[model samples]
Target chain A: MDLNTVKERAGPREFSPADDLPREYREAATRMIEFHANSEIMGAYLERPFIRQAPSIDRKLAFSAKVQDEIGHGQLLYRAAESLGVKTREEMLDDLANGDGKFLNCFHYPLKSWVEIPMISFFVDGAAMRRQATLRRTSWEPYAHAMDKVCFEEGFHVKHGEDILKELMTGSRAEQQRTQEAFEEWWPRIIQFFGPTDDKSTHHDFAASVGLKQQSNDELRDAFLDQYIPKARKHGLEIPDEPRIRERDDGTYAVEEGDLDWDEFFTIAKNDYEPGLGQINGRKQAQEAVQWVRETIEDDATTAGGHAPQAAD
Target chain B: MAALENPADLDEREREALETLLKRLADDEFVLAERYTEWQVRAPSLESDLALANNAQDELGHARLWYDVLEDLGFEEQELVYERDPADFRHATLVELPFEEGDWADAVLRSYLYDAAEELRLEALEDSSYPKIADRVGKIQSEEAYHLEHAQNWVERLADGEEGHQRLQDALDRLFPHALTLFEPVDPDVETDIVDLGLRDATLEELGEEWLSIVVPYLESLELELPVSSQVDDDTFEITEEMLPEKRGRDGSHTDAWADLHDELTHTYRDLGRSETTKIMEKPE
Candidate 1:
């Protein structure tokens, strides 16, 4: 279909692999979905260590399950992106390994301890969920379909994270203090999770115009602040003074953009942040190490008339 | 040979035997799950990663069920896991060994060996004198069937190619002896009581022989050699002193890796000075 007609027809679940989408629409949707896919993987990578380091067996099980869910989300999203025909899953994954793929800025920083876990799991995930809930109406049908499952499973992750936060905050003075400190450190990054304001988001206009983006950055950020700020305070965490978030007369919230480090956010967006490079390279090394297995499987598939080996009944 | 219907009915001797058997079952599942989780995001493909993670969670759930049975003896999660001494764990040495990076072969081969033994062990416990143990066996065995299939599928595919075959061979050589520790006695008297009391119908010797009978032929079919083939005589697998690792976990001895792993997993609990463990799921019935 022509670009003008595509724009006119763009709506929730409007586009599918079968659609005769214009190149511009396809490329834009691929970029947006690929970034989402990469973030899921990187987020899983960040939380992988905690599956081992969890304080209790139940917590370990929950963390492992949560991380597993994130990887599953990545798998779904890559397929959605691949359906756009702009790039294959391997190409996107290779791009991620090579540091050309972009993902959420919040994941770029290192998560050092259990105290910091809730900051990512609860607060950052809370923010992502606010945005994701809106994307259930995205123009890309497969992307929206993936979000349906992701949003279903993500509720447990956020609640589990909040459970951790509640436990830490209610514990001894040392535990409470460490948790508060972790909050202060991560609070700004959590605010930047929605990215720069709508004005500064380069692709926002085109994405929104095509109906691929369901909500603007500022709108999503406001929604997140409205919901999570009270939840954080309820858990006894003091919101950091910086990146001043102001409550509007209408009971909504907004972060002062000037207070956030957009320069650093942009650096991370470019995959140039130092700690994030470690995360990317570590995953790359793991991917490279297992290259032989994939090759072996691929060769086996060819020998067996292109059918992948599956679990025995 | 009749089932012991209630935990309250056990005498001190029976209690000790039941506890020993429970600890071995729980510890092996817990430790193997711990090791399996190391492959969470590092598996060769997304599909493989999800499959391995499912197996890990299944093993952990089995561990929780066994530990819950131990709770009837008045033990708590903190006392049983977090604050427990590393050497006190009764898992086999094979479950404690760390995987080398990117060794998908080790992951697959280890699962194959462990799950093969697990199937035989679960079958032996299917008619346990302890009613709780017998009841949980069917649920655990169903999950284990998938684990065994997953491992066998990968092992078969990997063993089909030159590079994959070489990698599988290396893993088999390193892991086969440790796997034998699965049937090692935690204590000779306690093991004897475990069988005499009918906590398990088969003795450890019988389980070990059955395990070897299953895995030995399977490995040979894939053109892989067992490191200690000469030890298998007349269908009875004899584990000589030289074939055993110095650290037999069942005997309260462990490799240095166990201590490090234990310390890391319990770090958050200790750092926060937690007296209670958080529970997210309802206690297994």
Candidate 2:
């Protein structure tokens, strides 16, 4: 109930909506979960086009299913965040549309070609899954529960993504060349996915102190690089030269923070970057277009003497 | 008529009729699923978005089943889909038309119209002469019942309000004619053989009349007007030449939109010079 007691009691799946949580803990948890939820939507938006552009029917079906899963993840997460009682799902989604919401930095860039798909689907999702696996023990019960399902579904996505990457890399020389180029362009943004180092992360201490965050920015980044770097090499993708990665004596990895663009990262974090703004407004316009449909259903429900039935999870 | 138990026993004429019927079924589901995926993150609410996406995947899975049946005729995925000519596709125009941004009315109304026809069509095929077609009908129909309910539920709700009613009316006017193309003949001789062989128990004309009998009354009950009321005679519906679109997809003719869509979907195959389409799921037994 009190902030000191809340801090002391924070542990894996320790808190739920039933708990009379302190405001600080709720707000922090809401922020973390909302960001995670927004990322799911934005990531889905990025992959939506490829559902149509996928070369084969099998690829198209997989892409559509994968994007659908991401939207489902967003649904689960927003419910988790709303259970915190800080902000409702509508408010969070509206915030995302209005450019006040933050998501992962990798989604801020434009995905132009089919070749660029695995860069986001495989490498970036692989990084996100690395962090998500640890969040299974998050202090918030609903958030961890959502992670339970998300982590299960995410393995398919990562595997499917790797399958696509393998197809491209083993194809003709031109296909392989284009895929490598896509990797080079997306590598820096993918590295920035973990955000700044432990020292530079502002909310890490408080979030970790509350058990909402299981790993620090530095720890997650190092773990991701150690695992995915070799996977990239195994796929014949050449890692970019800049953002120089250092191989530690323990066979771990670190990036030179100066080599990355924090200005651009912060700009996207604030939802002001141009291409990212396009992504945000595109979704906003779609939401506005279908406003009447929601109102119509709501009105019908009221006239029928009850609330509209919520969609089954 | 008895059902045909094995593909190996079919003569050339029966084989041609069966292939034509399967192409229509498979292409309609595949293309409609492609269009439905456009609504993934764009639906009005998060829950609705998920529902529509589920429907999309269901349609795609159904398409896979039909396409698998065609593979028994010695066709490969690449020859059937990726490298197939755009004009060779047999899907109806209703499924090919692109949705205007935020047009939830079109999405709902179109689904209502298509799913109603789907129900009748599936029932006609319940005793299909081809055992493969007959066996798969029950599985597909079970999933389709939910699609019909979801569409009907939305259409009734949308028609209840003035703005929603107006939107639904507009979508109905634009999409109704295209929906009729669903029953158009791919080949007159082949269609005749399809019925003569009992591949489907009813003819397209019979199915179209039954579909109109059902949808016409339902639309009128919601205070929605039918664009083709002039074509209705008593309880039976007949489609005239004017009621048809310029592009009858069953005849290997299509709108400009189909060309663009086909090219976009096949872009990856072309760019990568793929000789075969990837198979994610195993061949259906």
Tens-digit per-residue lDDT, A40-67, candidate 2: 9999999999998898778888999899
Error of 1 at A288 (Å): 0.7
* Winning candidate number (TM-score): 1
With a 3 Å backbone cut-off (N, CA, C), the pairs that clash in candidate 2 are B4-B129
Chain B TM-score against the true chain B, each candidate: 0.97, 0.97
TM-score of each: 0.98, 0.97
Candidates' chain A TM-scores: 0.98, 0.98
The Cα RMSD across the true interface for model 1 is 1.8
Clash totals in order: 0, 1
Cα lDDT, model 1, residue A3: 86
DockQ (Cα-based) per candidate? Answer: 0.71, 0.71
Which portions of model 1 miss their true places by more than 4 Å?
A307-313, B228-234
